[model samples]
Target: MKLQKLIILFFFILIGFAGISQNIMEPKDLIPANDEIVNWQLIDSVNTYTDEDLYMYINGGADLYLEYGFNKLGSCKYRNRLASKIILEVYQMKNDAGAFGVFTINSSGKGKKIEIGNEAVQYDYYLHFWKQNYYVRCASTVKSEGVIDTLQQLAKQVASKIELPGKKPELFVLFNKTGYPFKQVKYFKGQVALANIFNFSHGSVAGFNEGISGKLDDKMVFVFSYENEKQRREWFASLKGKMNMSMLFDQYTTVEDGFTVKDRMGIMLSFKPVGKYILAIKGMDWPEAQPVFEKTSTNLP
Candidate 1:
């Protein structure tokens, strides 16, 4: 009896270890299999891509994914009895922030927001969402009532398999607390995305570690964050020098801890550096921008 008890105890211990060490679900495993969803069946094996070969698959849009710390992808097709089809692509990113960043950039900001995942957007026959470190896309070739319903059903099934939860970036909360409640904000990892928002010079303050841009009340708000205060100060100094040389800005003047510049369009922009961040406001006069800047600075952690 003693020997049998020892063997059983050892088996339970191994099982516990195995459960603790289990890996996260693979991207393909999130998709529903044949009959998992009533009338839908997977058409073929899931295709996968990595950082090395994502360009081969996406071509034009691959750069943006790589910039946001893409890891791998799993893609496959689904078909119903009437031959209606849907394409499912699940992208595994480096972290939750990367997943959220990709979703933010791709969403039109006008799509109907849904609760399928941590955050999701749905269109006629398309849906995309981010949860944990995975970004999922469900698209249909043709738009029809049945296809749209199937698209949403597939999206919900995939989201349910992603057990972990994710939250918006910390900076987003800061922006909201500072009274800049932007409905649609673009989170950027580097210059590629920043340039998409507005063309700031390549070598300007474009080397930020991470940044966010959004439009509010007809003004564009930009907040750039660096790894440390020393780096931010260094970049701010370089930004001033670049602004002076570039024709994009006309009046460049030094302020208390930062500077102000005017674009050729006669829009005044003010920039202020506090802690490890550089905040800027465009299309606002000095008198108005000052109070906005002060309130944000006082609330910065």
Candidate 2:
């Protein structure tokens, strides 16, 4: 009876140890160091490589935030002695957040690795022909099992297609009639569009005024049109529930014969207070007014 009890206790202890080992990620599972083509050097931190180091190596860049406990990891280089065919990355897991992890291969021939922890997640990988004269990195949480693989594959694809541009894009600002700044806008000539930030005001509004005839998503816009007194009153009434109180206009005025029309000449000005800003929209259309309404609704002080 004593011998049987001892045996049962030993069996339970062995099972518990197995369970613990399975839960704990192993070094081999993190990064496979045995591959001949791929070489990995575990470094202490990310700052180990300097600008000079990056300049010296043709295929060298740093992979940071690997492993759950590790705050950061250092630079890595892939030497294509034969020819540069593929880009690879090797990383390690750091902390419980699973935000930091290494990139490596597995026995199933999968070409990526992830470090998942309780709080954070990280992606470490290499690119084939990266531009921008700096190492590219994307940091986010490890929310799923295949996230690492997805990121690694994306990095590979981006690196392969990267071409260094000759010059960078320029920035431009747009203003409304009242001269209040708008926070969100988009500018486009044809199919190519660029996002921008703009603000609105009471009488005058400014935004990306050009290439705004069509629809947009989550954008702020301003429009100017001609309307008669009655038409303008109806338009203002239509905006009652849609207008944000905090951004409503303080006052408005109407002008008779203000502009030339075939049969009639009249104009109206509707002013609304937009916190520190204000806005005036003439001949508001549903599509065009939507952005303005949204911006005012979520107005930022």
Candidate 3:
């Protein structure tokens, strides 16, 4: 009888560990349980998607997620007694950097920054954040009573369920030095996002690996990173060649290891290539942007 009881206890311990593992491994488990949030109930089963079929769900936006190294997605809907509906989406990216990249692009820069997860932003009808390798969004569809509050509540619950913490990319340090607000920064790896930032119109020159764009004191700063010095030089040469030949740019001038040009909009821009990164500042002359250029260049990884 003693031996049988011991065996039974061991079996239950194994089961307990398996359950914990399941909760950690499944992204869908990030959804708030019906009892987790007050008065809001999950309306249906969580929907899961992978890289192979994510397009069926998000359509045109799938490419953007894929560009950020998408892994899988889990989403669900919730309803409250007042008939308000909230949709929750948890995107599991390949890594923390990928998750942070997606969050930066998806967020509206004007949203109220919050502290629910590793980073969070709250809009009137939605709340989103990135934690660990998961990017979570909670959006309310109806403007019923307390709907916005519930949306944020639900987002917080989801964020708390995420067990690990996430770190921003290494390139973010350069932008940090410029005093750019964290919520206003954008990070990306490919042309899809690059086009949305400031269009150089030349699509992915030099095959750059990662980039950061942000605003500081009415000036726009851009940093593009390459795998090596060779690619950085190639990009610099291509951009310089374009500035010289393009009718859209004027007042092309060359400075020490860099150049300056004014676009058709008359916005003066400066560009400097240092180490494995290329730095550009819009709305600032080379002389003015040089200080910022050197500050960021000195911090390059």
The TM-score, computed over Cα atoms with residue i paired to residue i, of candidate 3 is 0.85
Model 1 quality (TM-score)? 0.86
Model 3: lowest-lDDT 10 consecutive positions: 197-206
Q: Per-residue CA lDDT of candidate 1, range 116-208, in tens?
A: 889989988899999988899999988888777788888889888887777678876677787766757888898777777766656587668
Clashes of each: 0, 51, 0
Off by over 4 Å in 1: 1-23, 80-84
Tens-place lDDT per residue, model 2, 90-193, is 22222222221111111111223332221112333322111222123332222444444544543443333323311111211223222345433222221112
Candidate with the larger lDDT of 2 and 3: 3
Q: List clashing residue pairs in candidate 1.
A: none
Per-residue lDDT of 161 in model 3: 81
Local accuracy by lDDT, each model: 0.83, 0.30, 0.83
Task: State the lDDT of candidate 3 residue by residue for 69-120, as single tens digits.
Answer: 9889998988877777888999998888999999998876888988888998
Better of 2 and 3 by TM-score: 3
* Model 3 lDDT at residue 32: 78
Please tell me which predicted candidate would have the highest TM-score against the true structure. 1
TM-score of each: 0.86, 0.22, 0.85
